[model samples]
Target: MKIIRSRDFTGSHAWEALDIASMNGITTRLHWTDQPYRWHVNDGEEVFVVLDGEIQMRYRENGQEQVAVLKVGDIFYASVGTEHVAHPLGVARVLVVESKGSV
Candidate 1:
């Protein structure tokens, strides 16, 4: 097991690293300080779990829409192949889990 502080690094509004996983999934923990960034899609689906503070999930919908406001213990999932931008209502930390499998 490993523990990481979101701001343990420098020049970053957020911090994240892969902890442990094998063949099944990958788990990552990230911390943000009321600063949300745009999410770039690559591969696999991702689930964001809010660890602290509040985060507002945003997505493009012709105009713009507020997906939802997530707080501590709140869980949200985003599908692959989409662009998203998250805005922090307050200092926020989140654990992001991504995996590739079908079952």
Candidate 2:
């Protein structure tokens, strides 16, 4: 077992670990005050869990924009190649697990 300290990372309120060889990883986000906003497309499917605070999923439709807010204890998912974005609604924290190849 391993313990990752939240203070390990400076300026960023998040930590990540995954199957380096398999390109799978898990990431934890602190709060929006720490720029909890994230825009990433995983190499594979991924899941997001709102542990604390709030988060919002952003996406574009017909050149317009849309959002889905998620509160604590909420969960969501994204598929590979599906362009999407995420950001904390306020001082929100989240955990995301996904496959990331070769570190």
lDDT of all the models against the reference?
A: 0.63, 0.56
Give the range where candidate 1 is weakest over 10 consecutive residues by summed lDDT. Answer: 9-18
The segments of candidate 2 whose C-alpha lies over 4 angstroms from its true place after superposition are 1-33, 36-38, 61-64, 101-103
Worst 10 residues of 2 by lDDT: 15-24
Candidate 2 lDDT, 1-103, residue by residue in tens: 4554433423334433322122325433332233444555667777777766677778665566678888878887776655567776555555566654411
Q: On a 0 to 100 scale, what is the lDDT of residue 84 in model 2?
A: 66
lDDT of 1 by residue, 12-42 (tens): 4453333434454554535455566765663
**For model 2, what is the C-alpha lDDT against the true structure?**
0.56
Tell me the spans in candidate 1 whose CA falls farther than 4 Å from its real position: 1-12, 15-25, 61-64, 99-103
Q: What TM-score against the true fold does each predicted structure earn?
A: 0.65, 0.60
